[model samples]
Target: MIVRVFGFSVIVSLSALAVAFLYRGWTGLALCAILGILEVSLSFDNAVINATVLERMSRFWQQMFLTVGIVIAVFGMRLLFPLAIVWITGGLAPVEAFRLAMNPPPDGADHFADGRPSYEAILLAAHPQIAAFGGMFLLLLFLNFVLGNRGLTWLSWIERPLGQLGRLDQLAVVIALVILVVAAEYLTPDSTRATVLISGILGAVTYLLVDGLSSLFQRRQPGGPDTSSVPGPPDGDCADRTDMQHGEIRSGEPARARHRPAPIAAAVGKAGFFLFLYLEVLDASFSFDGVIGAFAITPDPILIALGLGFIGAIFVRSITIYLVRQGTLGQYRYLEHGAHWAIGALAVILLVSIRVEINEVVTGLIGVAFIGASLASSVRANRRDGRHAHHEAVRTH
Candidate 1:
C-alpha cells in the first residue's frame, strides 16, 4: 500500500536525479537531490495542511491537483514565477529575465553595464515583498485556525483560549494587521517598508477573495445553516461527516473503519472551481518560501524546477493523497493542529528573514520538529485510549 501511494514520487525523484546528472554531472545531481530533500522537509507541514483541505475536495479535484496542479507547481511557481517577479520589480522583459536567470551576473556587477541586476540580487531585493505576501497569507491561515470557535485543540492551554475568542469574527484580521505593522516598522528596511506593507495588504486581500469565492461556491441545503460557516475546530480528528450516512452494509451497526470519521463531500460546480483556485493560491503561498530558499543553494532556475519543483512537489501531492485515503488525519488527531502551528512559526520566520538571513537547514528543522512532536502526541493519545478501552471491556465482562 505504501509503495502504491508513493511509487510516482519515487519515479519522479529518480528521474529528476538522472536528468540533473546528465545536464551538469555529479555536482548538479547532488544539488538537485539536496534541494529535493530540503523542499520535502520544509513542506511536510504543508502536506498535512493540504490533506485537511484536499480530503474535502471531490475525487475529480483530487486528481486535478495531482495532474494540472503539478504542472503549476513545477513550471509555474518554480520556473516562471521568479521571472515574473523580476519582470515586475526590475522592469525587465520576460525574455531578459529568463536570460538573467540562465546567466546571472556576479554579485555587485554594475547594472548599466550588465543591463540588469544579477538574478540572485534581484531575487534578494524582492525578498521583502515576497516575505510580506507569503507571510501574511500564512499568518491569516494560522489565525483562522487558532481563532475559530472550534473546541478541539492540540495545545489546550494556548489553543483553548484562542478558540474561545474565535467567536469574534475579524479578530484574526486585526491581529494579522498589527503583526504586519510591527514587521514593517521593526523588521523591514525603510526603503522597503511601504512595499512590505502594501504587499501584506494585498496578501490579506487575496486570501479573503479566494476564501469568499470558495464560500460562494459551496453547496447550500435548504433549511440548514451554511455548513462552511461553521468553522471546523482545530482538532484534526473531525473528518467529513457525510460518510456517516453509509453506516454498516452488513450488520446495521455504526461503521467504524479504523475508527475513521466520515468527511463532508466537497462542493461541485462553481464551488469546486473556486476551491480549486483556493488550493492553487495556497500552493503558491507555500512555494514562495521554497523558491526563495532555493536561491541560497543555486540560482539556476532549471535546477530549482527539477529538484524542488518536480521532486518535492510530487511527493507533497502524494503525501496529501495518502493522508486522505488512509484516514491518517482522523487517526492522528493532532497532526493538523501541529501543522498549523508550524505554519504560524514559518510565517514569523519568513517575516524575520527579510531582515536576517536564516539558513534553510534551520528552517527545515523547525517544521520537522513540530510535526514529529505532533505525531508523538497522537501516539500517546492512542495508547491512553487503548488502556481505557481495555478497562471498559474488563468491567463489562
Candidate 2:
C-alpha cells in the first residue's frame, strides 16, 4: 500500500514535470515542483482532515478520492482557480490572463505602475475581495461551530419553520445575498465594486452548493455504529470477556467486505465529506493569501509554482498521514478542535488581509502555535489518565 501510494505520487509529480518541460523545460518542471510543495504545505491540515474522512470510507471510495480528488485539487483549485480569478478581476480574457500570469512583468518595472510589489501593495490591490471572501467564510464557520455545539437544537426555532417551508438552504442564500448588497453599498469602491460583489456572491453560492452536494452524498451512503448505544465495559473479569467478544465479532468479518453503515458511521461519512469540501475551500482561501503574498516575493508565475508546489505537497501529505494513522484525533480529541479553530482563525486572517496586511509566515505561525498548544494539552491529559489508571489498578488489587 505504501508503495502504491508513493508510486502514484511519483507518477503525478513526474507527469506534472513532463508537462512543465513541454512548456518551459527545466524552469517549468522546477516551477511545478515548487508550487506543488507550497500547496502541500499550505494544505497540510486539509489532508489530515481528509484522511480522517477517508478512514471511514470504503476502500473503493478512498482510492477514488486520492486519485480524482488530487487532480481537482492540483489543477482545478490551485492552478485554474487563481487564473480564473485573475482573469475576471483584471478584465483580461482567459488566454490573456494565462499569458500574463505565466509571463509576469520583469522586476523593477513597477508591475502595478506604482512601486515594487510590497506586501502593502499587494494587500492594497486584493484587500477588498479578500476581505469579502474571508469575512463571509469566517462568519459562517463561527456560526456553524457555535450552533453545532448548541446541539443544533438552538436553530430549531428558526429552522423549524424553514424546514416546514422546505427551504432552509435558502436561508444561507439569503444571508449571502444580504452580504452581497452590503458589499456593493459600503465595502467595495465604485471602481471595483461590481467585481467584489460578483466574487463575494460567487464564494457564497459556491459554499452553499458544495455543502448541499456533500450533504446529499452523505444521505446516499450506508451508516455506521450507534455511538450513543456503545455501552461501557462491564465490571471486573466480565469486562475483559466483553471486550474479547467484541473483538471476536469484528474479527469474524472480512475487512474488505461491504457492510451496511450504521447510523453513526453514515453521519461520520457525511460529516467527513462536508469537512473535505470545507478543507478544500479553506486551502483555496489560504492559497489566495499565499498567492497574493507570493507576488511580494516574485510575480514570476513559473517561480511561484516551482517554489510552492513541489515542496508544499510532500509535507502536506506527510502531515495528513501522520494525523490519520497515529490516531491523533482519537487520542487527542481536542487537537481536531484546535485545528478547526485555527482554520477559523486563518479564515479571518484571509479576510482581514483584504483591509490590513498580515504576513503569511505570521499566519502560519499562529496556526502552528494553536496546534502545538493543543498537542501539549493532549499529552498532559494522556499522562494524567495513565497515572490515574495505575492508581485505580493498584487500589483494586
TM-score of each: 0.90, 0.67
RMSD for each model, in Å, please?
3.6, 9.0
- lDDT by residue (274-317, candidate 1, tens digit) is 77778888889888878988988888888999999889999998
> How high is the CA lDDT of each candidate model?
0.80, 0.52
Q: Pick the candidate with the highest lDDT.
A: 1
* TM-score between candidate 2 and the true structure: 0.67
Clash pairs for candidate 1? 147-166, 217-271, 240-262, 240-263, 240-264
Off-target runs (Cα >4 Å) in candidate 2 are 1-42, 112-127, 150-190, 193-198, 224-279
The sequence of per-residue lDDT tens digits that candidate 2 reaches over residues 1-397 is 4564466566656766787778677766666665665555555445544554555545454544555555555566446766676665566678877766655445534364554342223334755786567556544543343223121111245533533443343453555467557656754568878767766766766666665555566556554332211111111122233233343324333221111111134234554556456546755655566666665555555545544543354345545555555655556534554565566677666555544568876777777776777677767766666676677668779
